[model samples]
Target: MRHWIWVVAAFVAITPFTVNAAGAEPVGSAGALISGKSPDGLGTWTVRYQHFDGNSPVAAVINDRIDDAANHEVQHATWNGSTRRPWTFDATGTINVRPTTVSEIFVGQYNTDEPNMPMQSLGSVVCDSRSGTVITWDNLFQDKTSGLTRLSAEVEARLAPAASSNELRDWRRSGQFAPIDVNFKHWVATPQGIELHFPPLQFGRGLKIVTVPWASMSDQITPEFVAITE
Candidate 1:
C-alpha cells in the first residue's frame, strides 16, 4: 500500500491538466479532436480528446459522449489532495483508417481511492469500410458458435504455459477468466490477419497483444471479413 501511494503520486504529478487559480473559469473545455500518424507511415489516427473538466454540467455531458464513443464506463472517485474537488473525466484515443478497414484504440484512466489504483483500461473498435459497419468476432466466422469454440480453445492453449505466471495467476484468483468467449471488440486489422489487444489485468499488467494469423483461422472467416482484413 505504501508503494501504491508513491505510484499514485507519480501519476498525479505527470498527468497534464490546467488548474484555475481564481477558480472562476472552467478548468478546460471539452470535445476536441487530435490527430497524428506514425513516423514510419505504418498508421494514421485521431483521438477524441478532453482534459479534466471540473464538475461542470457541460463537461459532464462531453464526458458522457466520450465514454459512449469509446465503450467505457465512467469511474468515480474523490480527486486526490483536494476534498473539495470532485472526480474528473479525461479520455483520448486514436482511429486508424486504412483502405479496407478502420481500427480505433482508446485508453482511459481516472483517479480512485485505492492507493496507486487508477481505474484504467483500453478498448478498440474495428470497422469494415465496404459495408460501413462495425466488425465483431461473430461477423468474422462462418459458423459463429463453432468459431468461438475453436478460438477459445486456441487462446487457452496458447496461454496454458503461462497459467502459473504472476498476471494469469492473479487474474484466475480474481475470477475474471471467461474461457468460453474471447472479447473481440479490441482488435486491429493487419495484413497478416487481426491483432487483439487485451488490457491490463485481463492477462497481465500492461497491454497483452496477440496476433491471430489469417492462415490459422481462414476456414472460419467470412469472405467479407477476409477481404477487408487481408
Candidate 2:
C-alpha cells in the first residue's frame, strides 16, 4: 500500500461555510478520497492515522466538510491518538484543487507562537518508485504559533505513464524498487508561500510524492498539513 499526503500552501481569511454535496458517498482509496466526497455527503473530511510510525498500519477515516475549496481553511481533521501510537499528527485545514489551470492543492494552519523568523535550508530525498511523476517543496514550517525558522526539506517526484498500469503487480512481486532523489533549493517568502525546488528525475513507473515532516519539529507543518493540497 502507498502512503498519500496532500500539500497545502494557500491562506485566505473568510467566513467558514459547510460543503454539502447531494448523493455522494465517502471515498476509500487515496485517489478516490482526493477526488471524492465525505460519507455524510459534505465537502469536508475527518482523517485518522491508524499506524503512523508503526511497521504495520490500519485504515484512515475521512469525513466531509460544508464547502470544498476554501483557501488554507480545513473543515475537519483529527488523529485517533491511539492507532498511530507514540507518534501522531493530524489537522483540519482548508483544501484547494484546480485541475484545469493547475493540478495543485493547498492546506493551511496558523503558527501563532512566533513569526518573521529567519529561513533555513534543510535537505532532500529520492523516490524509490520508478513510475511516479510528482515532486514537493516545503519551507513555511517554523512554529505553529511563533512561526520561526528552524528546519525544511524538499521532495521531487518524476513519473512514467506506462508504469501506472503495472506498478501494483511489480512492487508486490519484487521488493526492490527504483530510486528518486530530493534536494534542498532555497527559502524565500512570496505569494506562493516559501519558494524552493529540486531537479527532476526520470522514472520508469508510478508517480512520486514527497513532503517535509513538520509534526516532527517543536513547531512545524508536515505534509499531513498539506495532504489535501497535492
Candidate 3:
C-alpha cells in the first residue's frame, strides 16, 4: 500500500473557533472541546505533524482546520508496516511518504486494518530552513510521554487570547485523550519538528472529529492514498 500522487484540497469547517494566544479562555460547547477516550478507552486519537528541509527533501502543503461535524467526514491512514484499516468517511487523506526513521508524517484514525503496519513509535520531528513553529517528539511510549507530558504542560498554561473556557470542559474530562500504550514504538528525528495534540475518536454516540487538512511529500514511487469512505 504505497501509491502516491495526491493533490486534492477543499476543507473549510472550523467553527466554535478560538485562538488568540494571550491568556485564552472559552472553548466550551463544541460538544465540550473534542471529547474523551484515553483512560484506557482506546481509539479517541489525536496527532499533529510537520516536516520539511532546505535544499528540499520535498515536504510542503500544510493546512489544519476543520471544525465540527466530526471533522466533516474524513478518515485517512497510511503507516506502512502496520495499522491502516479505517476507511469510511470520504473526503481525502494521504501520507505515501518514503524515508523513515520516525520524524513527522502520520495520518490519523487508529483502529488498524493493515497497510504498511509499523506503529508504536510516537516521537520524532525535524525540519530545515531555520525552524520556526518548533516541533520535537521522542520515543514517546510511556503513555504518550506521560499523556503528552500532561498535555503539553497543561495546554501551555492556558494560552490566552481566546479558546479556553474550561477548554471544552477540559476536552470532555481529560482532552479526548488516548495513549496508554496503543502499541507504538520506535522513531527518530530532530532537524526540528514535533507537535502532537490528539483527541477525537468515538465513531458512535457523539464525536469523532478528525480534522488536519492537507499534507504533501514525494520521493517518487506512489499509489497508496486511501481515505474515501462514504
Q: Which candidate is the best by lDDT?
A: 1
Candidate 3, residues 14-68, lDDT tens digits: the string is: 2233334662332211111222222222223333222222232232211222122
Cα lDDT, model 2, residue 222: 44
Q: What is the Cα-based lDDT of residue 153 in candidate 2?
A: 18
List the candidates ranked by TM-score, beginning with the highest.
Answer: 1, 3, 2
Each candidate's TM vs. the true structure?
0.57, 0.17, 0.25
Q: Please give the ranking of all candidate structures by lDDT, highest first, separated by commas.
A: 1, 3, 2
- The 10-residue segment with the lowest total lDDT in model 3: 221-230
User: Ten consecutive residues with minimal summed lDDT in candidate 1?
Assistant: 1-10
Output the lDDT of residue 69, model 1: 49
Candidate 1 lDDT over 58-126, as tens digits, reads 434434443344433221111122232223334465545556665556676654344655556666666
lDDT of each: 0.51, 0.25, 0.27
Question: RMSD, each candidate, Å?
Answer: 13.5, 20.7, 17.9
Between candidates 1 and 3, the one scoring higher on lDDT is: 1
Deviating ranges (above 4 Å) for candidate 3: 1-147, 154-161, 172-191, 197-230
